[model samples]
Target: MRSKVSIQKLTMSYYLKDRVVTALNGIDLEIADGEFLVVVGLSGCGKTTLLNILAGFIKPTGGEILLDGKPIAQAGLMNRGVVFQEYALFPWRTALQNVEFGLEMKGVDRKNRREIALKYLDLVHLTNFTNIYPHHLSGGMKQRVAVARAYAYEPEFMLMDEPFGALDAQTRESLQALTVEVWQKTRKTIFYVTHNIGEAVYLADRIIVLAGQPGRIYKEIRVDLPRPRDSFDPRYVELERETTRAVRQG
Candidate 1:
């Protein structure tokens, strides 16, 4: 697969009162087109920081990110979509309207945008809840709406930061499967950050472990297990153990 995004010698730091704290140092990575890549580490490892830089939410103090060989800062385009742990849905808007938000921003006509929004809602199995408001939806339902909203705009890269972290165990597992299903269909390059080893094992085509406190890549592990991945399978169990050990040791 072609490299869709590239990171070279990335570094980030910020002042916390009188001290300048480094969040990431000399980090480098490449995400392939249509690949599911997950970043895992202990807290303070800069996983979210890296994802934010890729989403164009923050500029790294040093180095640069490239989208298809062009500097992301110079690209002048909204080519990345992001999903967060919190269901960042509009409380006032119904599910359908919320999904329509990005399309509306893109200057899509009302009728056409509605059609596109509905299609994405259906993709996320939220067609039945189209008119439901965020306040009325359960946590999982709210996240499904968020996922639909992100996909509706057809972005080249999807940046996810612990999107399933807030949910119950069963709900998290359900959404994990839903995420893979959506990815298989859309084939969008996904840059996901999580501390959950099982989640990383299940979702990632490749996993990069970051060491904490001035985060740097400590290890890279590729998952060779077949999908519809069985977590209970021995190979799956072994890989999960290996990843857990890497995270602990890193």
Candidate 2:
């Protein structure tokens, strides 16, 4: 697969009081085009930091990022879409309007934006809730809106930070299936961060594990399980166990 994004010796650090906290250290990675990549580890492993840098929300303290062979100095919504665990929907905007928000910002005409938003709402199976507000929707429904909003913008890649973390077990599983369905249809390169080893194994074509305290890549595991993986299958169980052990060791 062709490289969509490349990181070379990536490092990040921040200062607090008289001390410095290193978030990432000498991280090198290559994300393939249309690949589903998941980053997993314990808290403070710089998973979110990596996702933030990839989204161009924060500049690395060292190293550089290349997007499609070009240096990415602060890419905005045009090139990347972010879906946070919090959903980040506008309370004032209806679900349809929330999905249309990015298109509106990009100056997409009303008719086109509405059409695109509706298409993605259908993709996430949320078409019936398009007129509802965030406060009126369930947690999973709100995340679906968030996913639709991200997809409506038509970005080449999606940066997801534990998007299903807040949901109940059943809802999370359902959303995971929805996310895979959307990914299969869109084929967008996805970089997702999560602490759930099972979820990562279930969703990713590849997994990168980060170790904490100036986090760095600890392991890279390629999951070759057949799509629509069975969580109860022995192979899936084995991989999940290995991934969990790697995270624990990290």
Candidate 3:
């Protein structure tokens, strides 16, 4: 598979108050172009730190991250888009404005940005609430808006940090289905960090399990449950159980 993003001996540490605490220890990962890779681990397992480094949101203490064979020097709009665990929608901006914000930053004119934003909103089935404020939207609706915002940006890769972690089970399932549809349609490479074993099994092309105090990749499992998966299927349950054990025992 072609690598869209590659990490070489990636390491991260925080020198907080002159104490060196390693967050990532000699890690390497490659996310293929148009692949959906889900990562599962216990809390504080450095999954979020890994995504942050890939996004250039946090500089790694050691090693490097490359996007499309080039070094990721800094945060740039062209590089990637991130969906937060918490829907980081701007409260003051309506759904449409929030989606258009990225285009505006890219210097796309008002006429074009609005057109693109609405198109994304429609794609996420949120066209009816384009004018709604973040506060007026439910948790699931807010997350859908955030997903639309990322799509509107037309990023080459997406880093999702448990985008559906805060939602109810039903909402999470719907969003997972919606995300798979978008991923198939756009072929955007995604590195999603989550703790949900079933969600990882249902969404990922491959699942990476991280373990240890300073997280390291424990196992890489290719999910062969097939697309449009049914969680009730025996194959799905089997893979989920295997992954869960790898994570717990790693």
Candidate 4:
């Protein structure tokens, strides 16, 4: 069977005036269905750029990205869902309304949309905040709403670009646990991007480290540790160290 997502010899470059800057250099990867994969790299390492190519937001100058043996041409709702570092919740919309926005776009009816959206809201433990606006919610709450919105649509895959980066350390850890719980319950395939090695190790089924000026796979580490992983575990620390060494080496 084909993988859920596949990248073959993926390359991207941006034209900065007359000089072309290479953002990615020959990236190849495959994500199995329901796999939680994390990518770590320093700033300017093309981690986010790589995700954009997979999500069809940025076209690669070289190579093709395939899903189920077919090349993806442009962005669409059927294949992928994306979340940003900053929670892009609509301030005017209440928590429930923000989640229901995606269903509204899909033409899901009012009654059905409310029912489905509520189920996901409850999954993220945000039922009480349903009637509250984005501004009324805390930073972590907004991200929870964002997660609910993304998952409520029930897309085949998720692309997260540092969704937890903006939160405090304690809040980040709490949300990470929440994310794991939701994933275990829902089995959603996620391509999560982060600079934190510990975050990657704690959440990922596999970790891919990107490195160098022209980003490439510096190291790919398979996390054999079983879930639900603890941040305090020695094995978790070891995995983070291995990925860290790969980054330094690259």
TM-score of each: 0.98, 0.98, 0.96, 0.97
Which residue pairs clash in candidate 2?
none
- The local lDDT score (0 to 100) that residue 179 gets in candidate 3 is 96
Cα deviation at 39, candidate 1, in Å, is 0.5
Query: For model 4, how big is the CA root-mean-square deviation?
Result: 1.2
* lDDT (tens digit, per residue) of candidate 2 on 1-250: 6589999999999879999999999999999999999999999889999998888888899998888888887555488999999988999999999999999988999999999999999999987999999999999999999999999999988999999999999999999999899999999999999999989999999999999988999999999998888999898998999899899898
Supply candidate 2's per-residue lDDT for 119. 99
lDDT of 4 by residue, 1-250 (tens): 5688888898899999889999999998998989999999998999999988878887899987777667877436457778888999999999999999999988999999999999999999998889999998999999999999999889888989999999999999999999999999989889999999889999999999999589999888999888788767898888888988887888
Model 3 per-residue lDDT tens digits across residues 94-128 = 99999999999888999999999999999889989
Cα error, residue 36 of model 3, in Å, equals 0.3
Error of 3 at 212 (Å): 1.9
**Superposed Cα RMSD, model 1:** 1.0
Look at candidate 3 and tell me the lDDT of residue 189: 91
For model 2, the run of ten residues with the poorest summed lDDT = 69-78
lDDT of 2: 0.93
Q: Which stretches of candidate 3 lie over 4 Å from their true place?
A: none
Candidate 4 lowest-lDDT run of ten: 69-78
